[model samples]
Target: MKSLAELAEIRERMKSKVVLREGGNEIRVVVGMATCGIAAGARPVLNAFVEGVNRESLTDKVTVTQTGCIGICQYEPVVEVFQAGKEKVTYVEMTAEKAEKVLQEHIKGGRVVEEYTITHAKKA
Candidate 1:
């Protein structure tokens, strides 16, 4: 917060930090936080994931984040798991309880919960 040159240098440092961190081998848990998602209790689901990560002391191994409109409003409060060098797993209609199960069974144990996946739904 001094001169323009100082501000530019700070901005460059922040950008570099983001890029460096983004290139790491961290698992990302992205929760949908659009209006539909929020209405369906996305906040608690997000909080549960954060709490689980912290409780397990896997902060460096995992990152909890949010997104908007996953294009499936019926599956609001969706949680998508992205592990480096692995296919993404999308969990639909999440709750705090379910999120904990996901964190334990999926994130920690490296197993996807097939029962909660959208692919398991019956097409009408």
Candidate 2:
């Protein structure tokens, strides 16, 4: 409780980093962060989405959040993309590098990378 001016200054600094989810054209990026997801490395994927959105100035449109188990253990590190009036895209077995591609291509360019998606069959 120093002064009102200091509090106001802090608020101003934080304003740029805040992304509201009330309304507007919001694209929801939900990362699975349950135990399996963590063991399979969801932290980096989550970080990638957050940092990528901030870097590309897409924070307003994209809302990155974490969720519990998506119930598909084999796809532990799953990422689900939800946009209005569009089918949700589920990305499985994600890595930090793959997360970057999703951020750059799917989130930015609007084209989902089929290879990284749930439908893609991994080679033996």
lDDT of each: 0.89, 0.89
What is the C-alpha lDDT profile of model 2 across 62-92, one tens digit per residue? 9899999978989879999999889999999
Off by over 4 Å in 2: 1-10, 14-25, 122-124
Error of 2 at 6 (Å): 8.7
- Clashing pairs for predicted structure model 2, backbone only: none
* Pairs with steric clashes in candidate 1: none
Off by over 4 Å in 1: 1-25
- Highest TM-score scorer: 2
TM-score of 2: 0.83
All candidates: TM-score: 0.79, 0.83
Q: What does candidate 1 score on TM?
A: 0.79
